[model samples]
Target chain A: MSIPRNWRTRQQRYSLKAEVCNTCNKHIFPPRDVCPHCAAEKQSWTNLSGQGEVFSYTTMYNAPAGFEEYAPYTMALVKLAEGPMVTAQLTDVDAQDVKIGMPVEMVTRKLSQEGEEGQILYGYKFRPMLREAA
Target chain B: MRDVVIIGVGQTRVEEHWGKSLRHMAHDAVMAAMKDAGIETADALYVGNMLSGELGGQEHVGALVADFIGLRGIEAMKVEAACASGAAALRVGMFAVASGIHDVVMVCGVEKMTDAVGDEVTSGLATAADQEYEVSQGISFVGLNALLMRRYMHQFDVKHEHFAGFAVNAHKNGANNPNAMFQSPIKAETYLRASMIADPINLMDSSPVCDGAACVILAPADGYRARAKAHILASAVATDSLAIHDRRDPLTLDAVALSSQKAYAQARITPTDVDLFEVHDAFTIMAALSLEAAGFAPRGRGVCMAVDNEIGIEGRLPISTMGGLKSRGHPVGATGVYQIVEVVAQLTGQAGKNQVQGARIGMAQNIGGSGATVITHILGGV
Candidate 1:
C-alpha cells in the first residue's frame, strides 16, 4: 500500500470506527460515505465495542508477497456485535484452537511491513476473548 | 435489440506460453477468430484483461492488441472485471452489435501470468478484492475462498473430501480437451489427498496460474446465417459488494444469482432446459457456490450434486465440459472467453469426446473477486 493510502485509513483501522445508518439502524464497518442498505445519506459515526464471533475462517499456508513472514496464519470473517462483518486475522490463538463461533475482541496490530525500511501497516485483528480457552 | 450471433471463435490452449508475449497471444487469437468468421475486419475490438498494467507493465491492451492485429483504426479499449474480464468483453461486443453501432465486433480475453513471478501474480490478483478493507487485511484471494469453504463445510455439515467430485469432473472433462492445461484425469482419492494451499483449499481445489488467450467475433444475425455457429441468447452482468463480508449471507452469491436470473429471463429458458454449463471453477468451492447461485441446485444442496456424481459429462447438468478454469488453466481474464468458446464447441457439435449429447443450449458463468462481479451468457444453435 502507498504511504498516503495507509495514513488515510487510520480511523477504521485503529478504533473500529463505523458508520451507522440512521434509517435502517445498521452499521457499516470501514465506513462508506453513505448507507449501503437504506442509502438514506442520514448517518452517524460510532466506535464499535469490537465484540464479535467468528463467521468463517482459514489458515493460509501460502501468504501474499509482503506477508510471507506471516505464512500459515489464520484469518476470519468476524461478525461484530454491531451486526456487521469484518475481515480480520485471528491472533493470540493457535489455528487449531480457532472455531467458527469463537467469541473474539478486536485488537489493533501490525498487519505487515512494506519492506525493511518501509512503514509497518497496522489494522484490526481478533483474539479470543477471555471468556473461553482450551 | 437486434440478434447477435457468434460467427467466429479462436483460442490458444490454456497453458504457459513462455515464448509468447501478451501482444503475440492477442494477435494470434484475434486473427484466428477473424479468419474463422471469414471477415476482413471488425468495427471495434474489446480486450478483456486484469493485471497487464501491474504484471505486464502494459495497461492499454485493447489498443495494444488491435494494433498488433493490424487493425489500428478501429475503436478499441480494455474491458475489465477482474477474472470476469473475458465475458465482460463479450458483453461489450454484444452491445455493440445489438445496438447497431457496429456491424461486427471482436472480443478477446488474454492474460500473461507466467511472465511475472508467483508472488507478483498473487498480489496482482488480490487487487480484484476490496483493497481498503479486504486486501489490507493480508488475505490472499485463495485464502478468501478458503474461508468460504471452511464456513460452507461447517454450515452444511460437509467434509472437505466432498469437494473431490468437482475436481474429478473437471479433470475428467479436461482430459478429453486437447486445449486443457491438465489433460490427465485424477481419481477422487487424488483430490482428497491433495496438498493444502490454504486449509480446506488444497492444490487440486485451486485453478492454476498460466498464460493463454481466447477470442470471439460477433456480428448481427441478419446477414450471417450461413457462417454463424451460435446465437447469443443472453449476455448479462451483475455485481455485489466487493468485500464478501459485506453481503447479507456470505455464502450466497447475489451477483451470480442476479446475473443468471437476468440471462435466464432474456434467454427465455429455465436452468433445466439448458443442456450444458461452463462454470468458473477457479476453486471447487466456487463451482458448488455457482451451481447453487445460478439456480441449478437448491441452496446448501450444491455439494450433493457433486457427491452424487451428477455433474459429469452425461449427468443431470454437465459442467466444466471443456476442462473449465481448473483443468483448463484459468488465465483469469482469458478463462471467461474460453468458457464461451467451449460452449460454442458444444452447441455446434464441435466438442469431440467431451461433448454433451445433443447439446442445444449452453450457459457460461464467469465470476470476478469472491463473487462480486458475475457475467452469465447463454448460447444456442443458430
Candidate 2:
C-alpha cells in the first residue's frame, strides 16, 4: 500500500463513509463512482452507523508479507445495518468466539506499518457490540 | 464464422522448476505443440500469464516468448484475466482462426512462481482481488475462499467432511497422471487429518502454488482436416463482481452459470451431452460451486455427486480427469491452458490412464478470482 493510496481513502477508513444510490436507495461501501445495482450516476454521501453482523469470517493462519505480525487474526465479511457488506478485521473477540450473525461495531485501528520509518496505516475493524442486560 | 479446431496440445509437468525460466517452460510447451501440429511457424501467438510482471519482473512477455520460440515477427500479445489467462488467450486464438484472419494461431500459458522468495508470490497472487477493498484488509486469496467455504457449509447445513470427496477424487485421478505435481493418491482420512491453512479449507483442499506451462495450437477445421484432433464447438466468457461481497448471492457463482450456459448454447448441447468436464478445482469449495453453477448438480448438493463417486472417470460425469488443479497443481495463469490440453488428450485418446471411456465431447471451465471471470470451452471429437 502506498502513502497516497492510504491517504486518499481516509474518509471511508476513518468514518465509515459510504455512498447511497439516489435512484435505488441502496448503500455502497468504499464508495463507487456509479451505483452498481441501478447504474444511477447520482449518489449521496452518508456515514454508516458502524454497526453490523458477521456474515462470514476466517482466521488466516498464513499471513502475507507485512502482515506476519498479525498472523492468525480473524477477518470477516460484516453485513452492515445499511445493507452493504464490508470486509474487515474482527477485534475485541477471539477467533473461536466469533460466530455467524454476531453483532459487531466498527472502530478505527492500526492496520499495518509500511516500513521501519514508513507511515502507519489505520483503518476500520469490527468488535463485538456490547450485549443488553437480560 | 468458420469452425476452429485444436490440432495439437503440449504441456510441461506442473512442478517447481527451479532451473527453468518462464520463457523456457513456455518454449518447451510451444515447441511440443508446434511439432504435434507439424508446423515450424505460427501466424500469431497469444501468451496467457498473470505474474510475469509481479513475480518475474518481466512484462511484454508476448514478444519475449515469440522471440525465444523463433516466431519473432508474428502477431504476439499477452492476454490476462487473473487465473483464467490461458483460456482467455485461447478464446482470442479461437476468434482469430474462426474469423479467417489467421490460418494458424498458438496460445501458450506459462507461470514461474518458485523464483520469488517468501510471501512475495502470495502478495503477487493477491493482486487478482479488489486491492482497495479486499486485499487492503490483509486477507490472502485462500482466506477469501475460506470465508466462502465457511458460509457455504453454514448455509447448506453441511459438514467439513462432506467436501473431502472433491480432494480425494482429484488425487485419485492425479495418481495416474505422470505430469501432475502430486502423483500420490490421498484418501478421505488424509483430507480429514490434513493441516488447516484457513478454517474449513485444509491443506489438502487447496491447490498447490507451483510453476509450469501448457499450450495448444488452433486452426480452421476446413484447412486442418487431417491434423484436427477436436473441433472447438464453443467458447464463452462471463464476469461477476470482483469483490465477492458485492454480489447479491456470493455462493451462486452467476458467472460460471452464465459462461457455461453460453458455451452449451453455442455448442447446441446440454450438460448431459458432455462426456467429461474439466472444472477449476482450485479449492474443494470452488469445485462444488462450479459443479452447481454449471448444472452438474443441484444447488448445495455438488459435493454429493463426488461423494457418490459420480465424478470418477467411470462415473456419470467425470471431472478433473487429469488430477485437476488440486493434485495436478494449479500454476494459476497456466491452469486454463492445462485444462484445454487435458481435454484435448481425452478427446484424442491420449490420456493414458485417466481417459474417459469413449469421450466424444468434453468441456473445460476455467475460473479467475473466485468466479469473477469464467471462460468455458466445449470441444467435440472429429
Candidate 3:
C-alpha cells in the first residue's frame, strides 16, 4: 500500500536527525519512535552536526537492480561524536581513504536519479572530515 | 507456555517444476501433511510464501489455501522472514498452541522461484539485504556470502579444499535423499574445479535456486497423533547487526551461536546430545560456519570436521541429513520448514535412505541473511 512506515519516516530525514531519550539521556542517531535503552516513549528529535567516525565499511563492485551506475561506491557505518550510529555512503572521498575509525561528517545531497526522468532522491551521506572551504 | 508438538510434516521433491502452478505446489504439500497427521482439517492456517506477491501477483495466500483445503472461516495469516519465512510461520503456529489458543494448526512454506527469470530472481532475493546501501551497490546474495567466505578463509588460514569437502559431503548425503534437488553425487575435485561465481565460491559451492513447498502441522501435546508426537522441545531465535559491515567480527556468526545456545538450553540438551542436524547450508561455507556456531566444533575447526568425515551420518554429529539447502535445494521461504520436516521424519523413523541410525534427539538451525536472523529448534523422540 503506502510506503512502509519506517521507510517513510526515514525518507523524511533528508539530512541528519537524532533521537534524544529523556530518561536515559542517550542520543540515538537515525531516530526511532521510542528510546531503546530506557524503554521510554518520550523522545526528542534534533538535527545532528553530521560529524562522526567510521566504525567499518565496504566497497561494492556490483550494484543491485536500480543502483548499477553507483558501483565502486563505498558504504560505511559512522558512529557520531555525540551518540548514535548511522550507515550511509561516503561521498567525494577516494576508495583508498576509506578505512575503519576514519573521521567522517554527514552531507545532504542527491543520492540517485529517479527512473529515466530527472527526478532526484535526496539523502544523507558521509565524507572524510575536511577543513571548511572559505 | 504450553507444550506443543509437531504432528505432521510433508514436502515435495525439489526440482524444476515446469508444469506445477504455485497453488497446486502448496496444495500438494499441505495435503500430504494432513494425510500424514490423519487430520482432515485444522483450526488455523499460517502460510509463508516469499516473493509471491512480487513475483506471482498473488497475496492473501493463507485465505487462498484455507479456502482450497475447505477450512473456510478459520483464522489464517501469513508470516514472512525473507528466506526463513517458513520457520517463522512454524513459530507462529507453535505460539498459537503454546499460548493455549488453537490446539491444531497448519504451517506451510512455499516458493515458486522458477516462475521468474534468473536475473529477476536474483534481484528479488537481494531485497533481504540493506536495499538502500548494499543492494544499490550491485551486491547480490551470492556476492555477499562470497565475501563472508573470503573473509573467513583469510582469517582462519583454511584452504579452499575445506569448502570443497563441505560441498562433496552435502552431495553424498543428497544422493541418498530422494527429495534432494541434486541427488547425483559430485567429487570434491570436480567441485573445486567448477567455475567461480564469486571469488572463493564456485558454482557447486552455492545452493541452487529451486521451486518447492514444505508443510508441518503443530498442536498441543494432547492433540498430537502417535506418528506425529515428536515434541517441539524448544524454538529460539536471535538477531545480529542488520548490515554485514556492522558486525564486530564478520567471521563469527553471533546470531547462530546465541540462538543455538538458547534453544539447547531450553531443551536441556548439549550439542553432543543431538543425534543429527539439518543446518542452513545455503552455502558450503555456511555449513562449516553453522557447525562451529552450533558448538559441534571449535572455531575454525569446521573444515577439519568435514575433511575427517565427522559431519556425515555415521560421524560423531551428523549434520544436514536431508542434503541441506546446499544439495536439497534453497526454495527461500520453504527451506526452514523443510529442515524441520526432515528432522521430524528422522525422529519418527520415516526417513528411509537419509535416516540416521538410532535418531533420538534432533536439532535444526535456519539462518537468514548471513546470520542476521537465526532460528534454532530442538526436537526429541520421546
Candidate 4:
C-alpha cells in the first residue's frame, strides 16, 4: 500500500462506494469503470448498505508480510445486500464465532498501519450485526 | 492452420534447487530437450515464468534464458499467466508454428522461489488476484482456497476427509516419480492429522513451493510426422473474474469449463476418450473443482472418483500421473510444462512403473489463480 494507491481507493474503502451499471443494474465493488455485466461505460454510483452475510470464510494462520501482526485473523467474503460479494477482514468477531450466512454489517475500521511513523490506512470491514436490516 | 507436433520434451527434477540459478535451471532443461530432439538450434524461444520479477529480483526472463542457453540472437520473450505461465508459454509457441510464424520453437517453463526471504513468495503470488479488492484484505492464496473449501463443504455437505483422497492419489503417483519433491506416499491418517495452514486447508492439501524447469520443442507436423512424440490436438485458454467473489457461482470454475470444452471440440473427443488428465492440483480444492469443471465428474462430486480409488493408473480416469503439484512440487510457472512432459511419457510408453496402461489420449489443464486463467492442451500419439 503506497500513499497514492491507498489515497485513490479511500472512497471505496471508507464508504463502501460501488459502481452500479444502470444498463444491467448490476453492482461492481472496489469500483471499476467498465460494467462487467453489460459493458456499459457510463454507470451510476451508490453507497452500499454494507449489510450482508458470510458466503465463505478463512483464518490466515500466517498473514502477508506487511500485515504480520494480525496473524491468525479471520477473513471472509461478505455477500452484500447490494448483491455483490466483497472481501474484507471480519472485525469484532472470533474465528469460532464465524459461520456461513452469519449476518454482518460494514463498518469503518483501521485496515493496516504503514511503516513506522507512516500513515494509518482505514477501510471498510464487516462485523456481526445486532439484527437483520429492514 | 498447420498442425503442430512435439519433437522433444525435457525437465529438471522439481526441488528446492538452492544451488542453481534461474537461467542455469532453464538452460539445463532446454539443452536436455535439444539433445533429445537432436537439434542444435531453433528459430525462437518462449519462457514461461512467474515471480521472477518479484522473487528472483529479475525480469525480461525471455532474453535472459536465451542468452544463457547460447542462442542470443533468436526471437525470445516470456509469457506469464501466474501459475499457468508454463502452459501459457507452450500455447504461444504452438501458435507460432501453427500460424506459420515460425517453423520451430522451444518453450521453457521455470520458476525459482526458494531464494527469497519471508513472505516474498507468498505476497508475490497474491498478485494473481485483484490487488485492490482481494489481496488488500490480507488473505494469502491458501486463505483464498480455504474460503472456497469451507463454502464447498457447507453447500454440498462434503467433509474435509473426502478431499484427502486427492492428496493421497497425487502422492501415491509422485512416489513413483524420481523427479518428485516428496518421493514417499502418505496414508489417509497423515492427511487427516496434517498441520493446518489455513483453516480447512491442511499442509497436505497445499502444493509445496519449490524450484524447477521443463521444456518442449515444437515444430510443424508435416515433416516431423515420423519422429513426433505427440501431436497437439488442442490448445485452448479462457479466463474469469480475477476476484472469486465477483463470479456468479464461485463454486463453478467457468474458465475451466470453457477452456476444456473448447479443447474437447477441437480434439473431437469427449472426456471418456481421454486417457489421463494432468490437473493443476495446486490445492486439493482446486483438484476437485477442476475435475467437475472439466466434465470428468458431476458438479460437487469431483472427490467421489478419487475416494473410490478410480484416480489410480489402472482406474477409469488417471490424474496427476506423475506426482502432480502436490507431490511433484509446483514450481509455479514450470508446472504446465511438467504436465506436458509427463503426458508425453505416458503416451509414448516411457512412463515406466507409473505408466497408464494403453495410454494414447491425455489432457493437461493448467490453472493460474484460484480459477482465473485456465489453459488446456490435449496431446496424443500421432
Candidate 5:
C-alpha cells in the first residue's frame, strides 16, 4: 500500500473511529463523510467502544496477498455495542473456539507490511473479551 | 421501446484455456455467435470482464476484441460490475436495441482466470468485496462465503448436509453438458468428504476457477420474429450494499429480490411462470441465498429446497438446468452470459440432455460480490 493512502486513514485504523449521522442517529464504521442510511451530510466522528459480539466469522486458511504469514487466522464481523458492524481479524483466540455472539474487544495490531521497503501497516483487530469482564 | 430478441448464442467450454488469450477466446465466441445468427457484423459490442487488468495486464478489452473480430469503429466498450459484468453488459446491449440505436448488438462475457496462479486469482476476486474494510482484514472471497454459510447454519438451525444436494444436482446435470468444466457427477457423500477450503465451506461447495467466453446477439424482434430463439421478456438490475455487513439483514439479499421482482413485473409474470432458472451458484450458500431472495423459497429455507430435491430439472422450479456456475465453472464475468446462453439453449430446444421439459419461460440471475449487484433477466421462447 502507498504511504500517503495508508497515513490518510490512520485514525480509523488505529482508534476505531466511526461516523454518526445527526439526522438518522445511526453509527457508521470506518467513517464516511455522508451517511449511507439517511443520506445526511451532518455527521460527527466518534470513537467506538471497541467491544462487541461476533455476528459471524471464518477461519481463513487461504490467505490473500500480503497476508501469507497470517494464514489459518480467524476473521469476524464484530457488531460493536454502538450498533455498527466492523470487519476485523480475531486475535488471542483459537479458530475452533470462536463462535457467534462471542464478546470481543478491539486492539491495535500490525496488519501487514506492504513491500520490503514499503510501510508496515497497523490496524485494529478484535480479541475475545474475558468472560469476567463482560 | 422496441422489444429485443436473442437470435443467437455461443460459448466456449468453461475450462482452463492456457493456449487462448482473452482476445482469442472472445473472438471464437463472437465468431460462433455471428455465425449462429447468420450475420457479418453488429452495430455495437459490449464486453463484460472483471479482471483483465489485474490478471491479464490488459484493459480496454471491448475495442481490442471488436477490432480482433474485424468489427472495429463500431461503438465498443467494456462493462464491469464485478462478477455480474456479463449481465450488466447484456443489459446495456438490451437498452441499445430497445432504444433503436443499434440494430444488432453483440454482448460477450469473457474471463481468463486460469492464466494466473491460485493465490493471484483469489486476491483478484477479493477485489469484489470491500477493499478498505473486508479485504483489508485479509479475508479471501471464499472466506466471506464461509462466514455466511456458518451464520446461515446457526441462524436457521440447518445442517451442512442440507446444502449437499445443490452441488450434487449441479454435477449431475453437468454430466450431460458438453461445455461444462466438470462433466463427471458427484455424490452428496463426496461433498461431505471433500476437503475444507474454509471451515464449513468445503471444496465441493465452491465453483472452479477457469477461462471462458459466452456471446449473445440481440436484435429487434420485429424482423427476426420467426427465427429468434427467445424474446427478452424482462431485463432488470439492482444493487445493495457492497459490504455484506451494511445490509439490514446479512442473510437476505435485497438486490436479488428487487431485481427479480422488477424483472417479473416487466415480464408480466411471477416466479412460478419461469420453467427454469439459471442462478449464480458461485457457492452453495449463494445458490440458497439466491433462491430465497428470488422467491423460490422462504427465508432460511433455501437449503431445504435443495434437500427436498425441488431444484432438479424434473422437479418444480428447476434451477441451474445446465450445470450452473458450480459444475460449468465460474469464469467470473463470463458466467452471466453463459447463463443466458444456456437459457437460450433450453428455450430453443437445443439443450440435448439437460433440457427442462416444456420450458417456455426462463430466468437468469447473475450476482456480483456477496449479494451486492444482481442482474435478473426473464426470457420467453417464441
Candidate 6:
C-alpha cells in the first residue's frame, strides 16, 4: 500500500493508460515498455480523457476489511475513448445503473491508506454520465 | 511432439483437512493415482499451487510434493497460472513426456486455502489480477465477476433466474458426488433468495475456496492398453494479457476460445462430438463464458441454453457433473486434475447417478487468472 517517494514523477499516470502498437496498432493498456505485437519499445504517451463506456462491470460484496466501507461496490471494465480498456471502480450510480456501453468519466479519489499521516493514496474511478445535454 | 496418454488419476475429498498436513494430503492424492496406474516411481513431477506466499509462508512446492511422494531424486518443478495452476501443471507434465525427454511423468495440483481467514484469502486471490491497476482501486474478484454477470444480463436479456438454474443444476449433480465439498442439493428459488454479493450475484453463485489435492499420471501413446480406461486425445494451452484491463472485451475470453479451438482441432472433434464437459466454473458467470468459448453455444447464448436446460445431463452437453469449482470445491491447484479425473470417470462408465448415458468423449477446460491462461483437454474411452 506504500507508494514510492518519486512515484508521481516516474509513473506516467495514476489512472489506467496504455499504448497502441504503431505497426499492428493494437491497444496495450498500462502501456508496456515494449510492444508485444511487433516487439518495438518505441511508443509515445497519450493522455486519455478517462471517459468511456462500460465494457463490463461486476458487484462484489465479499471484499477486504478496508474495503467493507464500500461494500457491494461496482467494478467495471471501461473501454476508453482512446481504445484500450481500463479496470476501475464505478461511482455516482447504482450497480444496476452500470451496464455495458454505459458512458462514464474518471474521477480521482482516495482509494486506501497504508498507515498514519500522509499515507493516503489517490486513484482514478469511473462514474456514469447521468445528466443529459442541455 | 509425441502422443501422450493418461494412465492414472486420483483425488482426495475436498473439505476441512485440518487434521492432516498439506504435504500429507498431497502425498495421499498422488499415491492413489500411482496405485491406479501401477507406477512405483516418476521420472519428473510438476505441482500446481497458488497462494503459498500468504497461506503457508512457503514456496517451491514441487520438490516438496516430490520428496514426500518418494520421488526424491527425480526432477521436480511447480507450475502456476492462478486457479488454473492444476491444468498448467498437467500441460507441463504432458510436454515432459511428449518431448521424449521422459517416458512417464506425474502431475499433482494441491491447495490448502483454508489456512487463511476470509479477508486474507480475498487479498491473496486478488493478486491474480493487476495489483497496481485494478486491486489498488479496491476491486475484488467477486466484484469483477459481478460486473461481468451484470453486463451479460443487460446485453443478452438474461435473467437472474438463469444464473440460479446453473447453481441449482450444479448442486443436484454435486449431491451425487461423494467427494464434493458441498454435496447438498439447492433449489433455484432458494439460491435466488440467498444473500447477494453483488446486485445479481449471491453467495450461492460463488465457489468456496477449499483444501484438496488431485493427481494424474501420463505416459507415451505406446504405453496405452485396452483396459487403460481413457486416452488423452489432445492438450492445448494458450495465454492472454495478464491484466483484465488489457482485454478488448471483458465478456469474451480469447485465450479460452483459442485454446479450446486448438484442442478440438487436435482431437478432430467439435463441441457436439463431446459427450460431457468439466469446464471451470470458478464463478457462476464463468460457466456461460466457458460454454461459449468451447463452441457448445454461441457468444451470449449460454444463458439462454442454461434457461432452456441445454447444458443439463439430459440435454445435448452435460457439464460439471462433479459440481465444478462452484460446488465441487475449488482447491486451486487440484481443480484441473479433478476435471480430468471426472472426465475419466464418466468415460469409464464409473460415474453413478449423475453420469451421462454411455459417456465416452469428454472435454475439460481449466483457466488461470481472469482468463490469462487456459488449457483445454479432450479425453476419450479406450
* Inter-residue clash pairs, candidate 5: none
> Candidate 4: which pairs clash?
none
Give, for candidate 3 chain A, the lowest lDDT window spanning 10 residues: A1-10
* Residue B76 lDDT in candidate 4: 99
- Listed for each candidate, the true contacts retained, as a fraction, are 0.87, 0.77, 0.14, 0.83, 0.77, 0.77
List ranges where model 2 is wrong by over 4 Å.
A131-134
What DockQ score does model 3 reach against the true complex? 0.18
For candidate 2, write residues A22-131 as lDDT tens digits: 99999988799889889989899999999989999999898888888889899999999989998899988999999999999989999888789988889999999986
Model 5 agreement with the true structure over A13-89: per-residue lDDT tens digits = 99988888999989988777788888889988788888999999988878998998878899888889999887789
* Model 1 per-residue lDDT at A57: 92
Clashes of 1: 0
Candidate 5: misplaced stretches above 4 Å?
Answer: A131-134
After superposing candidate 4 on the true structure, give the runs of residues whose Cα lies further than 4 Å from its correct spot: none
Instruction: Please provide, for model 5 over B254-294, each residue's C-alpha lDDT reduced to its tens digit, 9 standing for 90 to 100.
Output: 99999999999999998889899999999999999999999
Ranking by DockQ: 1, 4, 2, 5, 6, 3
- TM-score between model 3 and native: 0.82
Candidate 2 docking quality: incorrect, acceptable, medium or high? high
Residue-wise lDDT of candidate 4 within B1-382, one digit each (tens)? Answer: 9999999998999999989999999999999999988899999999999989989779999999999999999999999999999999999999999999999899999999999865877898888988889998888898899999999999999999999889999999999998899999999999999999889999999999899999999999998898799999999999999999988699999999999999999999999999999999999999999999999999998878775357888888999999999999999999999999999999999998889889999999999999999999999886
> Interface Cα RMSD for candidate 3?
5.0
Worst 10 residues of 1 chain B by lDDT: B301-310
Backbone clashes under 3 angstroms, per model: 0, 0, 5, 0, 0, 3
Worst 10 residues of 2 chain B by lDDT: B300-309
Query: How high a TM-score does candidate 5 get?
Result: 0.98
DockQ of 5: 0.81
Off by over 4 Å in 3: A1-63, A67-114, A118-134, B223-225
Q: 1 or 2, which is superior by lDDT?
A: 2
Residues B251-363 of candidate 2 have per-residue lDDT tens digits of 89999999999999999999999999999999999999999999989999887877635998998999999999999999999999999999999999999988998999999
